[model samples]
Target chain A: MKFRMYLMLPLLLAGLTAQGLEPLSRARLLADRSAVTPGGQETLGLQLVMAPGWHTYADPPGDSGMAPRINFKQPSDLRDASWRFPPPHAFRDAAGVTYGYENVALLLIDARVPPDAPVGGNWTVRADVEWLICRELCRPMFATVELELPVRDREVLFPNWTPLLRRGGWPAARE
Target chain B: MHKAKMWLGIVAVMLLGFGARAEKQAPGFELPDVQGKTYKLADNLGKIVVLEWTNYDCPFVKKFYTAGAMQELQREAVARGVVWLSICSSAPGKQGHFERDEWLRRMQSAKVAVPVLLDPDGKVGRAYGAKTTPHMFVIDAEGRLVYQGGIDDQPSARAQSLEGARNYVREALQALWDGQPVPLAEAKPYGCSVKY
Candidate 1:
């Protein structure tokens, strides 16, 4: 029995990874700072990294694909959560054309806290995400990601991927 | 005298049957079906016809087919005396391009009762502004473009989403056949890009 268990362990783990766990894509929550001051705005992001040859769609794919969306439950917790997807590459096929990212994509959200909230409070921000990935086939995946942030009077720099914002801005004209 | 009167009555009935009804003018196209039989839009005048853009490889298409959503709708539409035509605009050497034999086999397995019309050149698809696979269009008995848009309210690719999703095609057809105004004329389609 012990020998059989050991043999199947690797296979079981592989199956989990293949099912929504990703050899294809990983979704992570990021913030500009570990903590934020009351009423101050902090840049938050839902980051996506996909494998080569696979792509998740962009907002207004110019054709039929649905845009990647992120939403917060509370009304004002992530206030002014203006999301702007980086301009996507125009994917052309025999069908027509669509816009999306290959290998990597990031959805930007600006999070703001109400100044009147209690200080030293640790708040868990929950986000619901829905996205479609396609490459010869398509799969719709969704998950709710929670981010814990403590209210403090300090600021920190955004994550390393922020520079990708320069890649090309969204609502951009496509060729 | 009674026999002559009967003959005149039969002639009047025959003339009434040949009377032409007003047509709303859907774009005319003659395409070959899966069995290489020709189907012309003009030939179906005065009858409600449905044009559905489809591609087997498309996941959005799979959503409806795999879950039996689309096939069920097709059956229901046909049973109501509605003419359903499934068109494949996939270009040669592109995705969703299946030979006649393969297409016939797939449709049979899928239990699709409608004719699978081949539109390899995409002329018909482009003419009707077909943007995506699974894009649906319904023409009324008079040939007016009644509804042209998504298949349903829930655009998610998940099959389970269809449980609560409103079937737009069904709604449009129901209203049309009942001689009532179509509630919604068009809704944004959701799916993979239609392979032109």
Candidate 2:
């Protein structure tokens, strides 16, 4: 029985390692709401769940470090959307002060759809994200996320989810 | 096994304590300014000295200078007999590092009233562990580090926020003038990371 258990342990450990070994740390994309109107303004959420004691640089990583950069790719017919980064926390080291998020940071992005966008279909939204995660040392992480939303005519999608989308820095509407 | 664990815990505590101590002392060094005048920390004794690590290309630095926040601080500190040295530690080929003449031109254009020191090799910056553009430090008359860290609490790239945050340099100078301990000695400096 002992010999048989030993053989099983290696296989179990291998399976566990395989399950745990994700290239990047905790990364997920969440929407304030799962649904949206085809031609309306809605909030989209992107969250990076980093490993313990690791952090990503905030945008424009002023003299401190590299800030997180996001690239959104959608159909040319879709309206270009913008990302809202929250006020960043400052980091100080022997090198100087840098802006970044420690541990887990919630980065909120605002997405807009044209009023004439297609209705009654799922539209694909993809984002390529890159950031530097640092503890005592720094590591660069990249992730690509694709989200699908069910579109409806004029109906506000995820009305209840606005709070989650409001956490990061969002620009005021231009006059 | 219990004894061994106790020994391990003791070692861990000692290591942690050492790390804490390591974080407290200011980094050291020597660097020349825009005129090729070398400024060394040890030479500033008997005077209240201020160190402003700067990068001209950085927007945050621009905000302070363009808005007269840094100059105002420099004028005020100098009036109180503070030696304000603006040190640029940008490495060669980096964004902020410039020739002495170019640096002088930039300073003159910006109306910078303080001595603009150069650290092209970054020897002084590394010694003092100067990290960000606009990182600040205050050394007392006795040549002991009195205060080190950010210039203020706000970290925006906009000069509009300067009025709201408490200026660390001013506070330190005041404390020295009044013969009081600096109320807040160290804070997290915020700005563009020093291009080291």
Candidate 3:
């Protein structure tokens, strides 16, 4: 019994890395800041990484393919939220032309924290994301991602995600 | 004098192109069903016809089938004297391409009442420019291609999305029955690309 438990542990831990039901693509949430300031803006993102030779579509997926339908449940403390997707590449095949992202795609969302929100409490944001990944065959996959951050007077930036959030010439968060 | 003649030629060509676009005709085709019965587009000329590109293995296609939405639509359309034809364009060894016997079984299990046409060579699909499974086309009684695009406004593969989805095909069919022009003609089709 002890030997069997040790063998299963690695497999169970591996499952945590695969955030989606389908193994071909993984979806997770990331934020550019550890905390958000009252009346300030912060960027949160749904990061999708696909297996080699597999891809997911962008908005207005060109000739065929459905765009990812991601709905974010904004916390009451947030005033407004909007999303951004990186520029997509055109994938040409025998069927026709499609527009999508290969390898990795980061769909960023900008959330505004209301000025009157109580500080010191955590604000949790949840998103329901759906996408179709395709290689030779296609799979419709969905995942629920979440991020929580403390409401602080001063925003603490996470340098690791700041560069990525700024990539592709997306506009900076408005004050 | 030569320049004037060239200008006349260009104007004539432009007018002809516009005329063709206004009354684009659905391409004629002859395809076999799972039972090896051939169906011809010309044979259904005086009747309204619907062409539905389909692949059962596709999740987008299953979105409708699993919810019984597609079957209900087909039944209602057929009962109202509309001809609904579902075509499969997957090539051999590709997804959704099955031998005749298996194909027949799948249709039976799915309770598909419409004719399931086979286009293994994708010739007919290409002729109609069918890019996706569930790509739809509607032809009027005069064989004019009246509508071409997605079946509904909701493109998600989730079965739950069928609720409150504005079914474009159903609406188009209703308009034709009421002697009204289709409200929308073309939409960005959403589905898995037809396996060719």
Best by TM-score: 3
* True-structure lDDT of candidate 1: 0.77
Q: Write candidate 2's Cα lDDT for B63-134 as tens digits.
A: 788998889889998997888998888778877888877877988898888888777777777666566668
In terms of lDDT, the best-performing candidate is: 3
- Candidate 1 Cα outliers beyond 4 Å, as residue runs: A1-22, A37-40, A71-82, A114-121, A135-139, A153-161, A164-175, B1-24
Predictions' DockQ, in order: 0.34, 0.17, 0.67
- Residue B3, model 3, lDDT: 100
TM-score of chain A of each: 0.77, 0.71, 0.76
Residue ranges of candidate 3 with Cα displaced over 4 Å: A1-22, A76-82, A166-175, B1-23
TM-score of each model, paired residue for residue: 0.76, 0.56, 0.85
Best by DockQ: 3
CAPRI tier of model 3: medium
Candidate 1 chain B, run of 10 with poorest lDDT = B15-24
Error of 3 at A5 (Å): 21
Question: How do the residues A1-175 of candidate 1 rate in per-residue lDDT, one tens digit apiece?
Answer: 9999999999999989887466576676776677777887866667777778888888776567777756686535464456878867898765557888887676777777777756788656777777787786666767777777787767455454345444324334332
Candidate ranking under lDDT, highest first, comes to 3, 1, 2
lDDT of 3 by residue, A1-175 (tens): 9999999998887875564344888788888888888877877788887888999998879778889887766664332445677878999877878888888888877777777768898867887889999998888888887888898888888767755654433336332
Model 2 segments more than 4 A misplaced: A1-31, A34-175, B1-28
Cα lDDT of model 3 by residue, B1-196, tens digit: 9999999999879744531131389889999998899999999998999999999999999988877899999999999899999999999999999998898888889898999999999998988888898999989999998888889898999998899998888988999999999998877689999898
| lDDT by residue for model 1 (B83-143), tens | 9999999888877889888998898888888898999998888777787888888888777
Docking class of 1: acceptable
